[model samples]
Target: MSRRLEEILSNPEMQYLINNANNIENIQKYLPILSELAKKVKKHNTWFIEGLARCRVPYKDIEKYIDLDEILIDNCSIVGNIEIIRQLRNQKQDYQDYYVSSVIDIVCKTSEKTLEQTNKIEEYLTEKKYKYRFLPPDIYVIEFKSPNIKIPNQFGVYRYIDTEIEKQNLRIYFLIAAENNIIIRRNSIIEVVYIENFALFSLLFKFYRYTEKDKKDLEKYEKSREGLEKIIDKGFHEKDLEKIMKIFGKEERDKIMKKIKSYVDSHPDTIYKKLLELNIWFYRAY
Candidate 1:
């Protein structure tokens, strides 16, 4: 066994939990041990969350989850929640990174699509004597694989192992283990798609690549409101309506118009520009 594996195996608290697998209550009894283990393995420089998952210690403490999250998010190059695309406009950008921007395409739990394939993957792992375990909802970890095999060049890190029938190149790691089938490499291109999973409570995946055009558009939108704010601050000029309509799309213009109507009914002398300014500020405040 590698030194890393030895360290995990030799952990007295971890051994206690594994040996007492017959009793699920041991998890709560030994959470502090598990939290300590999480801190130790966190600096491994990968997102595997390795040792904690390896020992199958289910931590139930919300604070412990927050503590672990602080470690992972700090180290990740980029991270984002999985949500409806339409909701993104209203959601604030929650991110911290050392690099510019890149969106990584990730496909997870796709193996669960068909029962037959899921069984096949389990059988494959058994045949290879792979050390692996399932973390609730969908995360599956492959702990032990044949050593000394060369991993692909573009592969930044192996985050998770999933059952993928069709092989595709993704910046995110997805591997289905087989004898003499470990080698993998493919075209590194980016495409955006949205998939649904209601089981997860919050954001699960991280997007790595953001195109120049995408970044420019986001920057433009952020700065776009400033000029419009200035125009609205002056007075209700006829040209102000034209300017506000051009800055935002139909939905936004409709909102502006509705607010303007309400404001006109209340303050007859106030300009339509005041309504437009309030509408823009309302969304920005979020």
Candidate 2:
């Protein structure tokens, strides 16, 4: 077998399909189309293939009706198979919502130990006139939506903590809330699960549409931070400082560096503390 075909066969999802197939020989004929789909999706494309299988699309003619574009548009035309494909497409959309809701359910379940406490805390917050809402239990957990944090066109679970709350009770109130929430940030799918004492953050999916400006901005931001740290340790004469400041452009270079140096000298710990603060803000905002 060719290297690419071998790679596809070795994929865990593909292996599962192969090992469980009623006739392995029938699967072989579909490999070329699967390979092409995988290339288009930049992954195993198991979900698409499985959808076809579930619809009972014929192995010999699967490629004739279904292509990446048709799959994307949910407009595949299969003779005498239109109804099944239509149903599958509807299920595919519903499945996305179902999948997100399931993840939120699992995340909420992790905090079951603190649910009673959370309810009590919520009551207290309510009495104190804090702004919040409790979603239907079937859909999501109690949500303490802070007016302080808002991101347009995104939905996520957020933990709200009032500094006035007693430190002992703070842990109980730290609960994430939102059902079927997913963050789609600039062509990337960001999945974040936060329980009382657990957290999982990952870039779950990418659409590969990063622009040149985005890449340059990210690179410049990272390099500038690294350069600032070196300047803090080794002083203004640091050799690479000039190169790093050039990223900011000639007009703002000297003024910006001077301002940064002044702040660093006066409050050396601010940088570290600000990073932690930003993380907290991100968790609350998203």
Candidate 3:
């Protein structure tokens, strides 16, 4: 990774939330992304973390990380409930003649408990040496990718805070890399979800992990067989192939694309089924 990407991923505040993620529900009400991000952490070998929502001052070259003292999942939940109450009390009824009946909308639909998924993800990533970044709380958590903590600079959120929930309004500036750098704005109401609503996040995480693992394993095995063949045909012998494949670096696998195609032709179809599912090749050559 480049230094800028690394620095962003290793930002202390984001890392702290990942390192010490909270599982308790109430605290999630406070900093809800904990649970949502926890699940994400469990899914892919991507992303970084961030924290300290209340502090508005931006630090330049902040040598240290900013984070909550503890997981605070439960505390955040309590904060969410409080915010709800505040919203109810602050409802506007400008005129007795013009009072209109309206249904209250949930600012965040996720339960505080589910928000801990972020912590789990952090634990998983730290173990794998992957990277992530928690965009400043001012930024919305939008456009979640499998195994990543990326937010486009353009995904706009209403971007405010409700003191009771300590939940800041997040309008995700989710955009494709193509749309990120340019400066035109879209006013359409794009559906947005906050960390407070962590339901089903686990499912997304599980699917992502399963897919990533499959990709890695397929690449590793295909590369192994390729090396074995080279041993038989080239200068090296079978013994050399055995030794080399055994010492393969535990990497996510790429450069071995042709090795995978080889399996489709010369090896048993079952051995290559998983790779076929991953779409590693645009079309499997016979």
lDDT of 1 by residue, 1-286 (tens): 3566447546876565444332232234554544444443343322222222121111122112112222221111111221112123233322111122112123222222222333444565456444444323113222223232111211111223332222221111122211111111131111111122211111111101224543333333233244323333443234333333343456654554564465457546543334444445335423
Cand. 3 Cα-lDDT: 0.29
TM-score computed on alpha carbons, candidate 3: 0.18
TM-scores of all predicted structures:
0.23, 0.20, 0.18
**Residue-wise lDDT of candidate 2 within 1-286, one digit each (tens)?**
3456455546775554434322122333444444443353333222111101022223223223223122211111111112222223332332222111101112232223224334554565567554445432112111113212111212333333322223222211122433223332332333323222111011000001224542332222233343333322332222223323332344343343344344446556543223222222223322
TM-score of candidate 1 relative to the true fold: 0.23
For model 3, how does the per-residue alpha-carbon lDDT over 101-210 read when each residue is reduced to its tens digit?
A: 12111222343323343343345435533343443332333333533444422222211212211122221110111101111112212223332212112111222343
lDDT of each: 0.30, 0.29, 0.29
Model 1: weakest 10-residue lDDT segment is 198-207
Best by TM-score: 1
Off by more than 4 A, model 1: 1-12, 16-28, 38-161, 165-286
Question: In model 1, what is the error at residue 245, expressed in angstroms?
Answer: 37
Highest lDDT against the true fold, candidate? 1
Off by over 4 Å in 3: 1-114, 119-217, 222-263, 274-286
